[model samples]
Target: MERPNNVPLPGVSAARAAERATSLAAHLDARHRGQNAQALIRAAVKDLFRGRIALVSSFGADSAVLLHLVAQVDPTTPVIFVDTGQLFEETLQYRDQLVALLGLTDVRSVGPKTDRLARLDPENFLWQSNPDLCCRIRKVEPLAEAIGDFPAWISGRKRFQNAFRAELPVFEGDGARIKVNPLAEWTGKDVEAYRLEHGLPEHPLVKFGYLSIGCAPCTDRVKPGEDPRAGRWRGRAKTECGIHIAGSMTPENEGSGI
Candidate 1:
């Protein structure tokens, strides 16, 4: 019998899956490092993962550049957007604007389960008391569920975003799946240049200095001289939203938030 398209290889133990992701990440990183972003995305979407991969976009700040590149390569590629219930209204509108402008197909907007929210956070104050748990329910868990069937996924993280991401690789192993960062080598200037060169629309909030937009409650405007992601979860030690953390697919192991 033949395996179904886009489904993970069957019966592979978790350990085996992890090993495969590691090997694949190393291979892809070596082969595509320093290449153009479009070429990397093209290969991932059209040649390598093909039907088994998806793009996870936040549609904030410099997202339009990556979305435009992916649309150029293949507009029908699956795009996953985690609509944390607390996101800025501007972010949602920007998502819609970019989707229509880029002609993206298959944009999946996954959110935290309503039943889980009612049970764990009836008052929706989890972010004030336990941000890690809030992110687990709102961002990581939903994304994990959204990408459950994909063997690989793309992210828009770049090295210049912050110190924590200064050494981001072009590819990485996220538990059993391969995570590709086509823009890992791009700088803030590079992103802006691409957006201008391609005439992509900017995220509406960028003009107001919300360099790293996330959920409304946590995101803030950046100062004149700060890391692009500094405004995210301001005054908190949390640097990530737990979605990018290894083993984050499991709620119990959810790390920090971005």
Candidate 2:
């Protein structure tokens, strides 16, 4: 029998959940396609997802633009930050500064389980041998847990940031949840203008040529006329840390060394 659109499916399988999420994402993308970044964020945070959504931020370079928009909408909105335990000290301090300046009330910092780290990466050199696995334990897993209760989440990705994200949509499905990229259509000029207009502080590393900041070990300084994200995972084919990709989020017990 065909289920009605308004009817709820109880105990649906993972496949079914993903299908539903995809459908929801399409609808949302179409509905809010013409809205500006601020308007779109307001809708996602206040109207559409409301209490069931969160914003996952790296608190990296150019993060303040999106964070400022979200703050204007609701300073108390849940913001999930994954502390990979390998980030630059400047990044940590920048996170704190932004939270206080924006008056954000619910900023949660999550990291890998101590037991898992001790067993799988006691030497903390997993990033050297297996960057993907290191990200799985430090970023992907922790973020998955942080946003598990939410049906939707916001990302700070912008199309102008990198070629991989150049065609990013304002709304998309990630596993069983809807991922919103309010600034997907925004350009680099847009971000800089907004930041300066609002007097948003820049990440300290940006001045040192670290345009695309990540962990201290993996990130490097971008040379003149290079891609902003060229500094990430330098000399390696790896671009992302595995958090933004689909199917990267695994079950909590899948790789937990416990």
Candidate 3:
């Protein structure tokens, strides 16, 4: 029997993937090493990938700093926001407010296809029984489809947020696309100081201890002394939604906010 047609296949071979990753990693190390986040984003938005790139943001607790920097670099840079249909209403409103406040002109809101959701999660309780599947259906598939046209995309993950991201690089390639992590070297204090310096508005739930807000069903409040991302998928070992996972790689701990 032939393979199912609806499934997505890996686009690059193992040999090609390793070669591309090595080449890109070397280039990024030389050019972006020790560079600040704003400069890195500027290069990604205007110099390197330019029109072929988009910034992926959750507009969660740690979002304002990155969004503000991107706006300053180019408000017209494509900003892709994924709405899982399970997000808090406050997140939707916050997205609106930030778009206007930052003068971001090209923000695109994408989500799961209706038919897929109806077929797979009609009851809307998939997270209770299967959170990984729920994340893939809601987040991974949608984000993958949303950015398929781009050669490079930006992510907002930071090293300080979790153990899985401790050694993240400024540029990562899985042979298919270049993933930029401008804030890989940033710490919690750096983010907070920048947020306060720019007077960026915090997500409403941040005050309620929801440090890393995502779809309301899978997110929870972080207790004091926990990592900022501790509130996300509290009971599960799964951290990523598969959007950031390369072929055969362990799932990335994308944190609650990314």
In order of appearance, the predictions have TM-scores of 0.92, 0.93, 0.88
- Winner of 2 and 3 under TM-score: 2
lDDT tens digits by residue: candidate 2, 116-206: 7997899999989998888888888788788775878899898878889988999987767788999999887889899999999999999
RMSD of each candidate relative to the true structure: 3.4, 3.5, 7.0
Local accuracy by lDDT, each model: 0.85, 0.85, 0.80
Superior by lDDT: candidate 2 or candidate 3: 2
Estimate, for each residue in 78-187, the C-alpha lDDT of model 1 and write its tens digit. 99999989999999999999999889989999999888889878999999999988988898878888887687899999998998988899989877788999999888
Alpha carbon deviation, residue 140, candidate 1 (Å): 0.7
CA deviation > 4 Å runs, candidate 2: 1-10, 250-258
Task: Return model 3's CA RMSD, one decimal.
Answer: 7.0
lDDT of 2 at 179: 88
- Candidate 3's error at 193, in angstroms? 0.7
| Candidate 3 C-alpha lDDT tens digits along 1-258 | 121111113765545654665576567757779999999998888878778889999999999999999999999999999999999999999999999999999998989888878988999998888887788778876777777657678899999888888888898874456788899899989999999999999999999999888989889999999888888888888776667666422113222212
